[model samples]
Each structure stands twice: as structure tokens, then as C-alpha cells.
Target: MTLPDHGGLSGPEEIARFIDDPLTSSVLTSMADICLVLSPEGRIKAVSSKKGSPVTGVVAGWKDKVLSELIDSMSTEKMRKRVDQLAKDAASPEVSPPRWVELLHMLGQGETLPVRYALHLLHDKRHVLMLGQDQRPTIEMQQMLLNAQIALERDHEAQREIDTRYRLLMDFTSDSIILVSVGSGLIVDINHNAALMLARTRGDLLGKSLADYFADHTRDSLVAGLEKPVQVGSAAMMEVEIKSSQRRLQLSGKMFRASGEQLAIIRLSDPGAGVVADERLTSNLRQLFNHGSDAIVFSDRDGNILAASETFLNLTDVPSASAVRGRSLAEFLARGAVDLRVLLENARRAGQLRMYATKLNTDFGAQVGVEISATWLDDQFDPVLALVLRNASSAGAVRPDTGSGQDQNMQGVIELVGSSTLKDIVSETTDVIEKICIETALELTRNNRVAAAEMLGLSRQSLYVKLRKYDLVSKDEG
Candidate 1:
């Protein structure tokens, strides 16, 4: 039905005339910086943009141009589709959904600026109003977000690859390895060998208490042994009899942290059934210790030498074991009597004195830097102290290097004499020396805790304690 051109009414007919009026087109232009009036054929009937609008640079000569001509090839097809949709909706009585399309506005300089156009089919059925929003900033932001998502996906894929390799190695190893949660005694992971020895599938053993699988009487001992590594900072071994498998197995456990959670790795091995073989192995180990590369010495409680290895005799520049016999161990050590007292005192209390860096004075009057590991062997028929001395003089002195040599270090200590008490100066000097040794050990071992501990002749627990005392751990790691 057609409406009178100049009649006032309160229905769709009146609204249609209002939308067709030029005043409504001007109002639409005010709503956006760039506006376009398009015919049903997708040709631009009018174009308008606010003064100083960036869109003016690209859309200046768009009047009377087809919508397809004003936009790039891709947007031309999209505009055609939108126009077709609009025509179909105009024929129907239904109010169609608003159509939004992103178009590229072409310029004379061969550059294209992205334009987001909101299209509405006017009541006239012959024209469409297009309001454009500059989409450069929004599109650039979206592209950046897409790039970040891709990078995140790549990181996740790489992590998966690493996990896969780790899992494969753990499973294929012959060693029976189980990963257990420290908080709960439940096994979190197990290798193929571990799964077989437990007489259970991997799924059955995972998340199950390891202690529960053993004899009821041995559960407490088993748990305590597994947890020992956390305190000692290395693997501790214990023998446990598995009730399910009816086998005696030796378990060695090491504690570790991953993702801020404490975990323990327990390895199970069976000792072969032979007493004679065990005795032979014991003899072999004893022979190795006596003939080892490091100088070995056994002394009485009073530091009198009882026995000396050939290496020790060579180190002390003594001709034979008889020549060194009955001689006080301190006579050849740092400051002679003082160094011997310190070693005996520490060994008596802790049963061991390890990595004690000091000078060993030889028979020729030459001093050699050595690291001493002495242990109190009180369980023997005759109580004696065992010392293993590793020559470190050839490795350069243990004194802290200030870039200058030993003379400069000695001079610096002498310079502290006027301002500091003797005790204070000695304590500071000792601290500096210990710090330098720890740093060098860490560097030489490439920051590997196990290797560094061995290099410094200290237990892993001792090294960790000293690391904390000296505040040597990196701030980021802490």
C-alpha cells in the first residue's frame, strides 16, 4: 500500500516517510565520521564525512561511485552479497538483522585503510545507509592477539615433546624407578621394571601407597627410609621385603622438587643370592681404598701415625712407612699442632671432617695445599682416625684470589691488623676463603649440585647449608 506524500499518521507508513527524508540522511551522517547512501544496486548515491576526519583522505571522491568500486575486490563481493540480502528482506515484512562488513577503502597512493561498515536497509526499499568506523587500531590489536596465541601454542608443543622424551627414557630403563609424592606415600609414576616387580600394572600401582604393598611390620621402616633423602639431600638405601612378590629388594630414594611440590625417586634392586660373592666384593672395596690415588693415613686418637699407604709416604716425602710410623700427624699439617687438634675435635663430634683445606708440610720443608677428609673409626679393635688427603697445591692454592696472587692476599690480611682484632681478622679471612672455594666448586661443576658436592668433598646437605649461610643462591632461584 502507498501512503500520501504529505499526511501525518502514527504507523509504519509515517515512519517510512521520515526515514526517506533528506533530514534523516543528515542525521545519520552526524552519528558517524563517515557515512554513505547506497542504492539497491550497491552504487553510492552520496558520501559525507566530518571535517578533519581521517576517512576524508580515502573517501573524498566516493560520491556517485559504486560501493564495489570504493572498496577492494574482496569487500566488493561482500558488499554485493549484503545488498542482495537487503533487497530480499525489503520484499518481506520482517525487520532484517543488521549486516556488518569490514571493507578496505582504496586510496590513490596504493594504500588501503580498513573500514568497518554498519548497514541498514532504509524503509524506502531503494537505498541503504552505511556508517563506517575506522578499524585500523582494532584490526592491528587483533593481529597481535593472534600472534601471541600462536606463540603460546608453540611453547606448549615444545613442552609436550620434552615430556615425551623424558617419559620414554624412564620407561625403557632397566632400573626399577618409582616417583612418589612426599606428602602422600602414594606412587605418582613408575617405570616398566618397577611395574613388573610390584606384580601390578602401571595404572594399578599409580596413586597407591607404596608402603601398603610391603609387609605390615616393615611399613614404618620403609616410609622412614624413603623420606631420609629429603633430610640428607641425596639418596639413602634400605632393604625391604615385599610381601606381594616375596622378594628382598634394596630401595634407594632421592628427594626432588618439581613445580613447587616435593617428590621422591625410589629405585629398587635385588641383591643376588650368594654370600661368597658379597665377601669378594667387600675385599675388592677394601683393596681399592688402601691403594686409591689419594693419600690415606690411619692415626691413633692422639694423632700418632699408625699406618700409611704408599701414596701417603710419597706425599710426605718419606722414604718408607717405617720412617713415618709413630710420628704425630699434626707435625706435617697446617700450623702443625693447631691443625691436628681441629681435625681430631671435629671428627670426634661428627665422626667425620671433610674438605678441610689446609697446608701439609713435607719432609723437605715444602708446604702443599691439601683437602683432608678424616673420620673417627671407633668401632674397630683399636680406635683410630682415618685421613684421606687429596693434593690440591698443584691445583693452585685455596686462598681467595683478588685477581692478584698469594702475596697480595697475604698483604690484605696484614692490612686488616690495625683496625680489627686478631680473632675478627681470622674469622673474616676464613669466611672469604670458604666463599671462594664454594664459588669455584659451583663454577667448575657448571652449577650441578651433585658434582659440586663431590668436588668440594662435602655432603650435598652440607653444601646446601653453606649455600644458605653464605647467601650464594641466586635471588631469582630463592
Candidate 2:
């Protein structure tokens, strides 16, 4: 069917035809993704949206609302400026090209959608039309790409920082470090010291074989050492003469795995050169132990003094280590045999005794109260016991025999005062106490002779003699 041309109709007839035409609304709706008719004052006059679009939710109840209420803060000023520009252009004969402004449309649920819009001035000059293209998907894609780029930059920066620190440490250290390829045995990298030791520039030695730099007679040994697996905490030391360095040089090699490759770490040092103990260090240690407040003494398992510090001599009223060496520690302990024997036994059983109350008996018969911290050093070559005696008298008066059991025993002694002579009463009391103590020690040790002897501060023979004297031992134990 042929359509009549609107040019052939009169002015009034054209107006009537245009008002009755469905294409008027259809053309406005299809102009863009969204269409808005805004009054000269920047208020929304009418709104239309494309089917199945995000703008549909945005334009739901926007009619007659101001443009500031319809868009986000960032776009409110842009919309006002566009309306003012259109009003100014309405009076000008020369029409300006459509100006596009990117805006964020505010939806009912408080979500904002990005939209790029252009304003067109109507002939009536009282209203303007806005055509928008959805910019949400484009903006989201750009943002995601920007985030990925930023992460890539951060990774590169971190790797560069690590490389800088590693390079600084490698160059600053004095030890020669060489990285060799396990597959080809070629030098992969070398520090400055290694290059200087090899008498070759680093660039010249970068790809050279490790064994080629050693003396002709030692090349085979170096090659064999490279083939050996490197175990942690184990090192193989050998002597090699470099071509430039005529002196015998010590080479120690150990195996390590890094970045999926096994490599040998060979260190170079002067032969027969090692850290020697400084005389001042030994002097310091001697002064520390000999003059310190705590008296330190070293003894054998049998409680024979192996060595005694000066503090020990002062505590025991001895002149020097010579005065106490090889002497039984029991002679100086106030309890005689009992204290030293119990100390050694406990040190062996528990590795250490923290605080054991005892008395240091001086040759002048003065008793110095002390607490002993003893440790048993079970050395393979020279086993010994180390005792640290701290002065306990300074803390308080000497500890009294104030137990309930001791009180009762004293009471028994008191009760015999009127019944018998002092000598007879003392002999009877001593026998009864000895028998009870022997029985208690046997019970405490679960009938073990060696342990019981140690607990009672007696030799095995002495304990057996006492057991026989008191008839405290069973036939099986004897």
C-alpha cells in the first residue's frame, strides 16, 4: 500500500494527522534505550523505557519529579547545566550539536545505574528530550580490567623488592657462593668473592664447569664431591689449590634442593684455619665461676671433688682447688655422707636437683647454710657432676628439725630423762631410730639395694651391714 505524503497536506490537516498517528509515540519510544521529556525548569515531564531493560526499574515512578531526584549527586549538576544550555540555544539561530553527559540513574531500591545521555531542544522551547544509552555493563567490565592490572603491578613490585634484597645480601657477604646446575654441572651464578677466588670475571665463569677451575690433580676429587648427595647438617671437607691461589684451600660441599633442581653448595676457606678460643674468653669464664656469689664445684660420681671454684674454697674454708680435689664431698657437707649421696642419686634419677637444703661444713667447724642445684653431666668421655651452691643463710636462719615426727622423737627422749641414765637412754634411742630409718629407706626404694644405699647416704656394703645388724632385710634381699 502507498502512503500519502504529509508535504501535500495543509498546515491544520497535518496537525490533525500527526496527533492521530501512533508513530509519534513509537518514534519517541524507539529513539534510545531510555527517553525522558524534561520541562525547561529541569523537572521530569514524562518518562519511557525500552522493554526488558535495567532502566525500566529506574523510570517506574519518575514522572514530574525534578532531575536532581531522578539521578545521583554526580549527575545532578550536569543535568541542570544541560537544561540551561538548551534554553540559551532556543533563542539562537545556529543550533548546537547534541551534547552527551554520563550520569548515574537512581533506582527505587537505592541502586545506581550508569547511563550516557544527550539532550535535544524541542521546537516549543518549553520542553526537552533526553536519550540515554545504558553504560552499566561497559563500566563494570572496565572496572574489572582495572583491578586485574593493579594486582599484576603489585605482584611485579613484590618480586622486584625480593630480588633487590637478595642481590644486596649476596654481594655484601664475604663468603664465596656459586650456584651450579645439577643437570649439566655448569656454573649458573657466582658471587663477587667466588669470582675473585677463581681469578676470573663473573661473566667469564658464568657457564664454566665447576671442576675445570680446580688444580689438575684435585679435579677428579671435586667432580666426585659434586656427584655426592648433599644431606642436611653433613659436610665433606677437602683441600683444593686454585690456579691463581697456590696455597692449599679448603672446600666444603653440601647438597641442597631449590626450584626443582638439586645443587651443591661448596664453601672455600684456608686450610688448617679455624676459630680458636680466645684466652680472654677462658679467663672470663674462670673469673665468672670462681668469684661469682654461687659456689660451683665439679665432682665425680662417687662425690670426689674433681675441681672446686674459689667460692667453694671460701664456703668450705679451703685454700684452693688443690686442697679439695680428689677429696670426698661428704667431708664438707654438714650431713657427712647422707647429703652428697642423696644429691648425686637424685641428679642421676631426675637429670637435675633444683633446690636442696644442705650445709657446707668448714674445716674450722663452722656450718654455712646452703641450697644445692646439682646437674649430672653424663659425658661419654668424662662423666661428672656439676653443683651450684647458693648461700641460703642470707635468706633466713638455718632450717630447724621441726617436723611432727622429729617433735615426737624429741618428746620420747624427754620422757626417758627420769626413767634411766643418760647413756643407756641415748643408746636405746639411737638403735630404735637407726632401725626405723633403715626400714623406711628400704620401703622408699622399693627394696632396691643400690637406690636404698644412695637414699640413706651409705655405700652398698655399709647398707648391707646395717640391714644385717638390724635384721631389716628379707632372706631374698640378702
Best by lDDT: 1
lDDT for position 303 in model 1: 96
lDDT of each: 0.76, 0.74
Model 1 CA lDDT for position 229: 61
Worst 10 residues of 2 by lDDT: 1-10
Mind sharing the TM-score for model 2?
0.46
Cα lDDT for residue 175, model 1?
90
TM-score of 1: 0.47
Off by over 4 Å in 1: 1-34, 39-69, 92-101, 108-110, 133-138, 141-145, 216-232, 273-478
lDDT by residue (21-80, candidate 1, tens digit) is 656655666666677777766776666664455566456566667777767899888888
